[model samples]
Target: MNTSRGYLVIGGLVLAEAALLFVPVAILGAAINWPESLDFAPSQALPLIDGQLGQVRLGYGIYLVYSLAWVLIGPAIAWLALGRDKQVGPLFVVAVGLICAWALARAIGIIRWLTASTFLAETYAAATPEMRQTIDLIQSSVNAWGGAIGEILGVSLFTVGWLVVVSLIILRNGGLPRILGWSGLFVAPILASPVIELFGMEASIFISTLSIHLWLFAAGFMMVGMALFGKEA
Candidate 1:
């Protein structure tokens, strides 16, 4: 494809990524209160999941697909960055690796919601008292581990690391506008800030997540503009 077409494809992919994110957010937020619901104890959460099993399946299943798309997006972003600066060979590999790792980790984390959590929720409703205790313990462990992998590692660490690396490349190469790079750099830290919550500290998780969406929207539009205007900065 020609340069313009190539950029248009990547830009479309980026915007689609932003749009995909909204689907699960809206579905889960409406269905079960989602991220907050994730904090509920098993006694509280399982019943809710069992009650709205259909929505849980739909929301988390879509989320899994969205996370997997990150693998494709990593290469698309790397291609754009390479167009600006071909010298970032090793870093390019690392960035793509991080994105793929994030994708896999995210899938691992979300799979439980669609599969194990559902099973446990269904069983929890009919289990004996002893079995209920067992289910509760299992649910707690599952959520803790899954949350760490998906939220801390995939969402915060790998995502921020990829953005920081790509933003630096953008800044150094002067391929696109420098402001786009700086905007990404600014949002990267905000994304990372939520990781501090693991240490029992208060963090603005909602704001941090909103920042990610904003950055994606801004970056998507900028790329689409570059495609239309055929600008190579």
Candidate 2:
């Protein structure tokens, strides 16, 4: 029932979720390589060129679970922080919105990857002349799916916008460090810009993407936990 303790519990849960989510990345990396001896061209393995179908499936599943956790618990933590303060109410709303946007984007990305990968892999195995043409059609469909995902990424810029706003709220309320708050504000535009340029541009901005999201998630967990359980400084 202690406030700081609640924050710590939330933080611990986020960290634990992150660790579990990260494992699938390693698993996918290790299991994803295809054997050259398989003699199937990349086109044949459309779903996953190497024995990566299983890995993709597993990774996407893990991502889904973690994404859901973030969407649900993230708002609960934010509510805990902001609900009592009338000034913080807007920030809580922003946090909830951003978390929802991120969750939706993540879900779309997972589905796109799974569907495209599976279709390609199945078509690759059937490589008859007729199947080849069908494969081409499927490939086009996959490309369209990619475009759709790009749109989702673009729309998801709201996540960064909300984070920046929430960071400011946290700083103003004196619950978290000013440095982190400033970083979140500064990082938002950089993280959000890639969504607009994603179609034609290389997504190198995802470096910032990783940085911002990780920081927000970690900081939210720690700050909330401490607020819930820790003694005042």
Candidate 3:
């Protein structure tokens, strides 16, 4: 397909992915009364975990969709990059590879939690002291090694790489607004989240969520503009 059609199609998919995430967040935000941090204590998670994981399951289901969409997004970005005739530099290749790999990691983390961790949480809520200890050991092991560490590295690397690569693309190619390119500079703190957490600043989670969503919103606006009006370019 021609560049314009390519842009239109990929752009729409990105927007749809963003909506898939956004809508669920909005609904879950209300259902759960919108916890400030995405991380919730076992107590906070207990209600939904007990009831067929009603709201929580719905939210996680959407997260699964979000995860699946990321698989598409990495390739979509590459399609846009190639359509714009940008150099597919080593950095570009590395960024895309990391994004794709981490996308899978993210999927695994979410899926594992949905399938196992929540069940463990339900068990923990009911188990006797001795049983609770076993559940804790198993749950903590899954969280520490299976979920937390993997997702931390995966999210940090892919997101940081994503922002840098997209910034470079927008700055170098005129396919997108340069202001948007400059905005990509905002990803620095997100990249530093691991270090930030080490410093006891858990606020990095909120910052990362806010900024990335804003970035996606801005990108969607620009891309949809291209789709509707600038498709001939």
Candidate 4:
């Protein structure tokens, strides 16, 4: 029973990842765009409340909280997949660590927005002109440090490092399909995205966001399917 339950626990994590991809899908269903501009710089913090969340807590707050969920848990699926086969290696361990960093920094960005930015939004409409200065300063600092640097670097490590490493191992070492192996490699922009972003290609941010989430959905389901089939095998 203990053995059976262990697999079940890992499987649930993957399933959770797959489900979170639909958070955006559901957004589209409701005629909302993906929260593209929500990554507001500090100067643009006021819009977080008025712009994205649309002057309501329930609107944007729920989305950020949902993001924090998968960002925090999605990386663990990789480790659980490796452990399921009892094939733990130093390289894969390193990959998992990068994923953890990716998840953590992204979550912190969201948390900062939820806490500090939302506070700004809630007070913006009511604050005196003199009070706006203090609010803007705090928002600017947090937005720059928290969102711009932290999330960007975390994603850079994830896209350039872990995705490549995991894909290579899956293709050459794991006994998976050659096409899926090849497909995994296509997910990251190899020589572009992360590297080019350093020189200033902001579009890469959107690309990475879409690509990474899709990768999570794909990777998660692959592990869950493997785990289930392996159980019967």
How badly does each model clash, as a count of residue pairs?
Answer: 1, 14, 0, 0
* RMSD (Cα, Å) of model 3: 3.0
RMSD to true structure for each model, in Å? 1.6, 4.5, 3.0, 4.6
CA lDDT of each candidate?
Answer: 0.85, 0.60, 0.65, 0.57
TM-scores vs. true structure, each candidate: 0.94, 0.76, 0.82, 0.69
In candidate 3, what are the lDDT values of residues 130-176, reduced to their tens digit?
88767766765666554454346666666667777767766766567
TM-score of 3: 0.82
Which is the better candidate, 1 or 4, if ranked by TM-score? Answer: 1
Model 1 CA deviation exceeding 4 Å by range:
84-88
The residue-by-residue lDDT of candidate 2 on 138-233, one tens digit each, is: 666665565345334633465676667667666766555555567777777666665655466544443654666577566656565466656421
Candidate rank order under TM-score? 1, 3, 2, 4
lDDT against true structure, model 2: 0.60
RMSD of 1: 1.6
Winning model by lDDT: 1
- The per-residue C-alpha lDDT of model 1 at residue 65 equals 93
Clash pairs (backbone) in predicted model 4: none
